[model samples]
Target chain A: MNEYYNSAYKPLLAIDCVIFGYEQGELKVLLTRRKQDPYKGAWGLATGFLHFGESLHYAAERVLKKQTGLDRIYMDQLSTFGEVDRDPEARVISLVYYALIKVESQTLETLEKNQAQWFSITALPKLMFDHETMIQMSWGKLRRKSRYQPIGFELLPEKFTLPELQSLYEAIHQKQFDKRNFRKKILATGLLKKLDEKQKGVSKKGAYYYVFEEGKYDELISQGFNFELKSMAFGS
Target chain B: MNEYYNSAYKPLLAIDCVIFGYEQGELKVLLTRRKQDPYKGAWGLATGFLHFGESLHYAAERVLKKQTGLDRIYMDQLSTFGEVDRDPEARVISLVYYALIKVESQTLETLEKNQAQWFSITALPKLMFDHETMIQMSWGKLRRKSRYQPIGFELLPEKFTLPELQSLYEAIHQKQFDKRNFRKKILATGLLKKLDEKQKGVSKKGAYYYVFEEGKYDELISQGFNFELKSMAFGS
Candidate 1:
């Protein structure tokens, strides 16, 4: 083993999170104002350097918790960004992670203190560095992953109505869907269990709530199932 | 600008290319023996440090060209691997890019000089660091991406038969697809233009050769047409 080659070619590693949440009828991303320079005060994705004695997931989770005070949130690795001067200050490489969390979760207050804000996808501000591009890529990823995977459920409350579910898909998809067709396709998948309860907040004809039937979806997916919603019939 | 908060941190960034090709009815990944140490002689993904002023895509192309003497390949960013000690030699953050190329296009002489070899996914040897895991992840990515994207075409010859196309999918999917439905769904996408010519190498009942309708696919994709291969009639 050449010790010189081992020691000489050290590369820096960091992780950045593209935290997403749905609230107020729009798709929004969680971002923070950088408190440091080179790009100090510029709004960027919630990110940090990887620490010793931790896995990449743990490090990302730590950054999420520290920045948002949210624990056990839905997070997944997105990609790694490593252009040599992507950081300008150095050869910093970022392992980007994407997260979808309930908007009403308790983490909002902590994020507020840290200058974290949620910007609607259609109305995003100019972000620092390549963060805007990161968000855009994350959106494309979310749209793709949400279809085959049961991740759309992550954007909704544990108990949600059919209309709410459709809207969640609409927001993520950025297109309208026919209610009946959407319901038919979703129910046909056998991945949503209709609860005996109704949503009390909005109606005389109250909408029934449902929870994800994860087991059935998993079984079907193992048998090679694809969840597709892109169609003229669904009002795309 | 609070320089104090950011002045101390500088990091290194590296790029790892997950170059994949199809040959002998199997999907293979390009692996190189680490010439320099830390893990000298250990097998790893064909990777290199990102140089200044080059884009990520350029870096990926450079890595591929250096190893295979191949250019203009179908490549995209897969994900970043940023475990703190993912590189035991350094805090290197690796942005993993995946490339799909025709197995026959890359000459063996170039790879021999570069000490790189293509290994079947199923028969891979022990790799350094997280490369084995990276390769597995890239395989999953290929499976997923190939299902909805026109990427499998990258692994096929410029012109190929329906059987050849199906074989490529099966190699990546590792499953038997119903031939009738597979052909129907793929042809229906309008991304494969049937040539008048037939491949007469195997049988008298020659199969028609088809070329990837790249121009049409690109135009349609821009106009929001999706390419997917899931079918209800596929296995039923």
Candidate 2:
């Protein structure tokens, strides 16, 4: 550390990650049981201290990767929560981040093997030291972001039916929307390209699949579109 | 600070504030000239170091209060920037915040006494390390937020005409809009309540004044109205 760095008394910096995944018509967060004292054995967000010569983004990504056993997750800085005495043992100011990952069967196995388990956002276990608040806020961000812009698409397979897309939105907003209005509102966005292919296994007369059009989304964004989902029947 | 707080090799925490004010139909940011070096005399955002036991919010407020001499302002966290060696002197991570303030003449004088001046976002002077990037990102946040919600209204007086309101929007988006369509779109939100009063000094036929209805705004928000200023007209 430089002399200037060492001159002042500093606060211990840390990162806490809230990993969200959409699975089986639900939004879930990954929690790992704390192995040590203070909040020993309690469910909590995957945590790591910022190491020397590491950027905050790198530290956060490293933490998420370690816990999820997967690389290149869609992670972002949700916000920083520095409540002075947030950490009981230390005066730590944490840069809290949230990651959205797709939970396929293979990835789910990878997570379980790494000692992390997915808990539904609504039915979370007792969390340690403000971790619950962190998770709640992360869910709030996801909900708000999904409303204003398109997300949760990453959790979907490349081709998914309108029903699957609606289920993802319902899981995020925690509300059952009217099927007719949901379909109308989503189609109005012009960002979802309808595919000719249909689901094979579920039924004889299968529903058509759709894929999110990234180029069209970007084009609409440049025109000041917020991906705003408005006037839709949220729950019927 | 507690003993546990002092138990680690911690990094110094700091905050930089980007104070935005709208004047003469242009968006401006408050800048102060540095009295000391590495970038001595360069223009920079109002900044302060986070002290022990002080939350990041409090530290940011103190910094803004010092610069603008305003007791209350609409301030929110923009994001955290920590690229290990960002500061040449130390490993410092800054929590940057942006604030929106009404620039009335009374408050403007207080800012001058504090040796801070407002610069148009488009014509900013060379800034200190990473301050420019911080300002740009803050602007991006503000633009996105204003598009999704009604924010520039804080920069307006208690009452104003549609032209005045439109001017504020233009300043924020940095683009002119078609007046007829802008009026039609704004009135449709029902967020604005028109007053019978009109400006006496401006012209013989003055425009009708209007005020934002907070109660209606809140009601609409609860109904999932995003305060979204969607497409009406961008440049004429």
Candidate 3:
């Protein structure tokens, strides 16, 4: 590496994972206590220094799995933060990615309690460094992705109700939506197949259950059909 | 600076700028020759190594100035590329930014041929090392940003004809639009102040010149109007 390049200036690059999980009908983000010199004992996004031989995607996945004991989750690169002093110790450039996980089934209860926990985004504590700005950016990306892609399915179980999907969108968007228009737009996408089931625990109405039709969504996308769910117009 | 932190694995970060300029009624991107080893003869995005203690924004702005000989242009961070072998010479991560420069004036002719040249996007050569992908991504961002913001004015002169503005849109979107509808939508925005002067070179009708009202556009955004130039229908 030295023979091929200049060795004078080298900045440390790290990868941070903003894992968003929907559990018990609320949107939550995973955080952990930093046990090092900078921001010691303060809650921050789960992060790790990148290994030399691995790719960014692999590093992000490794951090997610090591922290939560989960694998094969959906993650997307969000943005890179390179403020000179974002890290108090060094010029560390952090590439942030967001992960969507269904927390009800993948919860690691035995993970280091002093180091890790899921916090409701609405009631999050004051974070260290620029972690709060990263979360806000990830939240905005998630909201935009939810409307443009069938990502709401990533936050729910294998089977879910229309109301569950609507509620998830509302939570991510932080607004109310008209139920009829919401259902109309979502079902019109033709990407959800009604399952012969009902979510029995919550409602007497037993809202109809549905599963995301992966094949149909891909096929429709290939044919140029857009998946859009318009939020209820604000202050209308 | 190296008391507690290990400095063994730091990699040099570089900034590659995708400078966009509109000229000859087409969208253009600035490219440079790789002056050093790696791909010495191949054309690539204008780039330079990040200097110590300089923020990414400052490095990007500096590179833009070095290549274009222009200042205070429309610049934005697109994304960062960090594949281990992306540089071929070292583990170099490139922070890419997209910019808009006024090209119709003599400013573009003064560009140093040794460092940069503006190429029409459609006739661009095979770029070096994931640069083609970077250009495509930046182009997509440019299109989306144009629709949601008033940045499209950056590409036009201080005063331009309606046909010129339409041509700029067509060049970016790569599609033909209904002239009447385009005129109606733009005039409805009330953000274009018509000038008493007319462009005499084009037609007998002598298209009127217009100036973009940045203040009016900003006020309208605060009043809840979105800047949308794309067709609402599938094939309209």
Clashes of each: 4, 0, 0
Chain A (alone) TM-scores for all candidate structures: 0.90, 0.90, 0.92
Per-residue error (Å), model 3, residue B66: 1.1
- lDDT of residue B196 for candidate 2: 85
Each model's lDDT comes to 0.79, 0.83, 0.81
Q: What TM value does model 1 have? A: 0.89
Judge candidate 3 at residue A219 and give its lDDT. Answer: 94
> How many angstroms is residue A108 displaced in model 1 relative to the true structure, after the best TM-score fit?
6.6
Give the better candidate number (2 or 3) by TM-score. Answer: 3
Cα-based lDDT at residue A209, candidate 2: 94
lDDT of 2 by residue, A63-115 (tens): 98788766887888988888987878877888899988877633656766766
Alpha-carbon lDDT of model 2:
0.83
lDDT value for model 3:
0.81
TM-score of each: 0.89, 0.90, 0.93
lDDT-based ranking, best first? 2, 3, 1
The segments of candidate 2 whose C-alpha lies over 4 angstroms from its true place after superposition are A1-7, A105-109, A184-197, A213-226, A233-236, B1-9, B105-109, B219-224, B233-236
Q: Is the docking of candidate 2 incorrect, acceptable, medium or high quality?
A: acceptable
Per-residue error at B145 for model 2, in Å?
1.7
Each model's DockQ score: 0.43, 0.48, 0.55
Give the best candidate by TM-score. 3
